[model samples]
Target: MNSVQSLIQPQVLAQIGFAGIVALTLTGALIAVFPRNILYNILGLIVCLTGVAGIFVYLGSPFIALMELLIYVGAICISIIFAIMLSRPLHLSLPKRALPKVGLALGVGAAVFIMLSAIISRTEWQPAAMRSSDWSIATLGAYLLTRYNLVFEVISLVLLVAILGAIIIAGYARRSPS
Candidate 1:
């Protein structure tokens, strides 16, 4: 037990955890992007978002991590899955990918990557000026409720409308046999 404990120190464990999180994020992103199946893509997105939440937690922001999980994974991904499942039959064969379009996408992606890399390398990163340290959950909730309540309500309404639309479409799809 002592030997095992010595071999797996806190610093080593932390490094391993960080590496695992990064690997998860990358793998999930690849899965999301490269898969042809919509269901698989959604699952990959969930994995990627979960990995991002893990990274936020690792960076010492548990609130942001929880919000990421709750909003992206729980609400958005689930809603997407529900819509996809109800809208169409999963067994239908997807059309083959066009080579020219794939090539174009790769070229565009590479260009964007190079541009972002150049911009990031040339930019001087600076820490923000330290403000009041009252970043408690209660304080954040109060601020959101008081100042950003309209934005919050608007977003909620949008989501509600989207969900309702999805339900209506699903119902219509079911009734009209293709």
Candidate 2:
């Protein structure tokens, strides 16, 4: 009963959610990269950004997660979609994959993987002698309220200005004689 209860706990649920988010992110990234269609790529990018917001939540920053969703998906992706709509359409006939290019890509990937593995295996990781334990949620909250408050406010102001600028530019483009 206790084991079952533990499995249904918030921590376990969060772990499952994290795994799902990671899967979602990877799927979106694959879709974004593999598809030739511009619209599909943009949609995939939105999905991927949403998944990344989930990841930010998993990493213990819901504020960052919300900001990520708002900035990337809400602002950037929407702007991109609007731009796509306004721009001249590229005739997107699918091209056949070349065998030599595929082979060369695979070869390079394998070489990079092997090199990374060798470097990682050869390296000895040692913790810093004076590593600080100042990464607690309490410390984070305190810092946000105190030390980083001005920085946060400045960033928020900048983002607001940027968003307004983007909107104005977009609107101006619409109003201008094409």
Candidate 3:
């Protein structure tokens, strides 16, 4: 019983959970980028977003986590999947990767990674001076409906427009023979 208790310690469990979440995020990112299949890429993106939501929960922001899951994974990804399904046949082969473009992308990704690493290492991250006590879901909803309503509506409109544009473009592509 003592050994079992030691194995089940909170800190140990937390560390394991964090490691698993990080692995999930990395795996999803790799799947998203490396896959040639569009469906696989979307699935990977959903996995990555889910991992991010898990991270948010681990960081004590359940509201943001739930929003991530709902907005990104639930709404956006599903819409993308629908667009893909409506647009093209799953068995159609995509164009082969260009080596030069791949190299350029790698270079850019490395540069951005290095730049972000330097900035993160240099910056002094501090807590807010005045922490708000009213961080409940109800309060956040009220604020979104009241103060940030315009921004919220704008974002929704943008997403809708983007989705519509994708559908139109896909339809056009389908109509035009390669």
lDDT of 3 by residue, 108-132 (tens): 9999999999999999999999987
Candidate 2: tens digits of C-alpha lDDT, residues 1-178:
9988987899898888888999999888878767778788888998998999999988767888989999899989997887877765642555677889989998998999999999999999888989786656788789988999999889999989988998888666568676
lDDT of 1 by residue, 1-178 (tens): 8867865898778888888999999899989988788778888999999999999989877899999999999999997887777657762557689999999999999999999999999999897887677758898899889898999899999989987897787655557655
Off by over 4 Å in 1: 1-7, 164-178
Q: How many collisions between residues are there in candidate 1?
A: 0
Report lDDT per candidate: 0.86, 0.85, 0.88
Which residues of candidate 2, in runs, are more than 4 Å off? Answer: 1-7, 91-96, 106-178
Best by lDDT: 3
Residue-pair clash count for candidate 3: 0
| Comparison by lDDT, 2 against 3, better one | 3
The lDDT of model 3 is: 0.88
Q: State the lDDT at 67 in candidate 3.
A: 93
The Cα RMSD in angstroms, rounded to one decimal, for candidate 3 relative to the true structure is 3.1
Model 2 accuracy (lDDT, Cα): 0.85
Total clashing pairs in model 2: 0
